[model samples]
Target chain A: MRLSIENLYHTYGKGLAFETAALKDVSFTIEEGEFVSFIGSTGCGKSTLAQHLNGLLKPDSGRVLVDGKDINEKTPEAMALRHRIGLVFQYPEYQLFEETVLKDVMFGPKNLGCSEEDALRRSRGALSLVSIDPDIFGQRSPFELSGGQKRRVAIAGVLAMEPELLILDEPTAGLDPQGHDEILDMVLALRKNPKLSIVMISHNMADVVELSDKILLLSHGELLKLGTPQEVFGDAELMARSGILPPPAASFVRRLAEKNSFFSSLSPALTTEAAAEEIAKALQGKFE
Target chain B: MENIIEVKNITFSYPESEEDAPAEPTLKDLSLDIRNGEFVAIVGPNGSGKSTLAKCLNALLLPEEGKVCVAGMDTSDEDLIWKIRSQVGMVFQNPDNQLVSSVVEDDVAFGPENLGVDPAEIRRRVDEALKAVNMYDNRRKGPHQLSGGQKQRVAIAGVLAMQSSCMIFDEPTAMLDPSGRAEIIDVICDLHRQGKTIVLITHFMEEAAKADRIVVLKDGQLAMEGTPLEVFAREDRLREMKLVLPFAIELADQLKARGIELPKDIVTEEDLMAALESLTAGRKTAGEAVPCA
Candidate 1:
């Protein structure tokens, strides 16, 4: 799905003593099959914007368009359009309340009015896509699974909806290093569908750099910058201003460039392997 | 310094359900000591028993076999449970769940209040604890009004008000954003400077690198234990345990693979930068051609 947000404005506790703008005049477009990431410090309205994409929140003013059609319209077609965008919330495992893992995943498809058999098939497919063995874990209670498994099961619930565009809010938050990698791998595998677009909201800059095709930076309810990972993370000053750090390799190269002229010629690298390769080449030239 | 906590061959397992015949022990014969005023970080993959070991530290979950002692008080002794608990405070992963009262100061005061400390003493402790975490200004604000970092600080303050000599934080920054994570880590470091024994259980290798000592667990057993320099140097073993190295160490490893010689002790970003700067500095002094700006 091609999603676009135009001049989105939202406020909480309007006209009250503590009235605050949660999102303000934010605008961005997400192309089909593109992996987009929304990143900013906490309370920068990343989550607020994610909700808007799926019509979970009504914008006080502005439009959310899915495939050139406004999703906020009061029509059956608009409602179905909104369902095509699935949002997996932070700590989504807390929402799992089913006796069996398969049943839990089937809940979303079933709720969307799919037949029982159809929902079961979708649930099995989703679980397998997440690398969970549906045959092995299908009958087990979700609560009995490990923390990482429970989180994946929760994600599978969203996948069972068969969303054209999926928005995950901090999908790897609270997971161990291995679990974190697993989730990222699952996301990559899901993209194999070719028709599924993803919008990830994450604090891990490294993961953002590794996965995102395009990045949307939000700062205090405003769309600060929208560009490729290199474009967004390349600017050290902007990252500092937004209260976020660049990916490790980028930050290291930037710091090195600041301290020495020799390192200044090296571009900011997003991954450690790339940074190491560049540094090694530079050192080889100097020594040889 | 003397040991504040000692776990000797402790084993723990959750009760089995009807479907699962028997549950494996979460922690198996795990033995370790936390020195008084020492900062220790426990790291492992999920189900590696980091949280279970933390619970065992505070007597929240007693070991099924062996013993856990806090400052010479045995955790298995029913009467000493409260005494041990009061001495070792725990801060959990989720900030919202740990908070009890709507107001920040009220929440901080809850611990001492439960201990039946007089109101005057509770007031003094609350003020000191809130100030310590740098949340003095937000004391009057409702917890819901604070950010994730602020809420975690308030949670730390709640433990501080109880005058616990040792604090066990179980992935306290797991749910926080980058800035919030930094805030909590800063508070933890500050507390450590104040001579409070710290037991930090975290998955963030960078956070663990700050601790004086690091312990690695795997399959419910102690896999490795040493200073950060010692444990981080063994990249192969750490990878086997499913733990990622800190960014600097990971980079250093990659550099080493590319035939770059860096000091083995490099763990933090600062260490890596200094090592690279020195290497480049030597080349500059050798009269290498300067690259264009």
Candidate 2:
């Protein structure tokens, strides 16, 4: 699905003394089936923009469009569109409430009015989608599991819904190194399927580098820059100006290039894989 | 030679879960000695007992089998709970949950007041604590009104008001943004530099690299312990422990795998860049540099 936000503004407590504009004139689009990352400093309206897509938040001004159709159309199709967009909150595990993991995973599809059999089937598939063992763990209580396990079960709940677009708001927070990588790999795999559109709100630049096809930079609730990861990370000056730190790898590669023209010439190889390839070639040349 | 905090074969388990594994300690017989004014980072994958270790340090949970001594006071001594906590201030993972008072200054004062300090003394300590965390300007602000980072700083300030000679942070940056995490790390280091023994429990390799000592825990046992370079130098061991290194270290390791001449102890972006520059610099200064590939 292609998600488009036009002239969007989100204000809390309108017409009151506590009135604060959380988002001001923020607009961007996620092309169909593209992995788009939303990066910004804290309180930069990344979450606000994501909430706008599913009607969880209504814009104070302007509109949100999914597949060129305005989401605020007040039609049954608009309501259906909301279901097609799955919004996973941060610490989704905290939201899990069912007695068993299977029931919890099946909750979303069941809410969508799927048959008992169908919901259970999707739940099984979803458990596997998140790399959980459906037979063993699905029968146990979510509370009985570890923190990382609870998180995967919660994500499975959303996956069971089988939405076209998955909006993950800091899904990797509080996870240890192994747990963080597992979630990131799940995300990276989903992006490769060529049908899932992703809108990830992340503080980890490494995630953005590996997963995002386009980067939408937000600053003070306004759109700062929208481009490919390379293009966005290539501009060290712009990243610094926008109060966003570049991914460690991009920032490192750039600093390397600054001290040596060879690295700078390679320019926008921001990922670790890319950096290694460039240096390997440079070394092979040195030997020859 | 002077250790501010010492753990002698300590073991701990939640009171409720004590019987779940009676034979084995939920936290194994771990031993450590933290010198005054040192910033030490304790890291492991989830359920590796880092948080349990932090709680044990402050006597929130007593050891089932051994002992935890904070500033020479044994955690097993019930009467010393307050004194132990005051001496070793703790900052939890979630600041929102830990903060009891609504306003900043009041929260800071709460710590001092709980220790039976005088009203005037509490006021002075509160102000001093807030200033230490750079939250003095927001003294009157509501905790809800502050950002996550600021709220955490306020929490730290509250901890500081107790005038603790030691501080323990349990995954403090786990819930914060990069800048927020950076700010918290700076404050933690600042406190350490002021002669307070600091123990940081986290999963972030980058943050752990900044510490003077890095201890990796696995399966409730100490898997590895050393300086950041010493711990990270064993790439295979770290990867085997299910721990992640800083991106720079991983990037440098990848280059090393491909037979590139780069330092293995690269912990930060700038460090790796500087190392790479020197790798090329010596050549450029040579009689004739190698041509580009």
Local distance difference test scores for all models: 0.91, 0.85
What DockQ, on C-alphas, does every prediction get? 0.54, 0.53
Task: Give each candidate's fraction of reference contacts reproduced.
Answer: 0.61, 0.60
- Model 1 chain A: worst 10 consecutive residues (lDDT sum): A259-268
Q: What is the lDDT of residue A77 in candidate 2?
A: 93
Cα interface RMSD of each candidate: 4.7, 4.2
Report RMSD (Å) for each prediction in the order shown: 2.2, 2.7
Please provide, for model 2 over B134-238, each residue's C-alpha lDDT reduced to its tens digit, 9 standing for 90 to 100: 999999989989889999999998888888888899989889999999999999888877878889999888889889999888767788999998998887888
lDDT score at residue A53, model 2, on the 0-100 scale: 83
Question: Residues A77-173, candidate 1, lDDT per residue (tens digit)?
Answer: 9999999999999989999999999999999999999999999999999999999999999999999887788999999999999999999999999
Model 2's TM-score against the true structure? 0.93
lDDT for each residue of candidate 1 in B209-246, tens digit (9 for 90 to 100):
99999999898999999999999878888888778889
What's the CA error at residue A114 for candidate 1, in Å?
1.9
- In lDDT terms, how accurate is model 1? 0.91
Candidate 2 lDDT over residue span A199-280, tens digit each: 8999988888888889999998888899999888888788988888887766666666566765545545777888788766
Evaluate candidate 1 and give its CAPRI docking class based on DockQ. Answer: medium
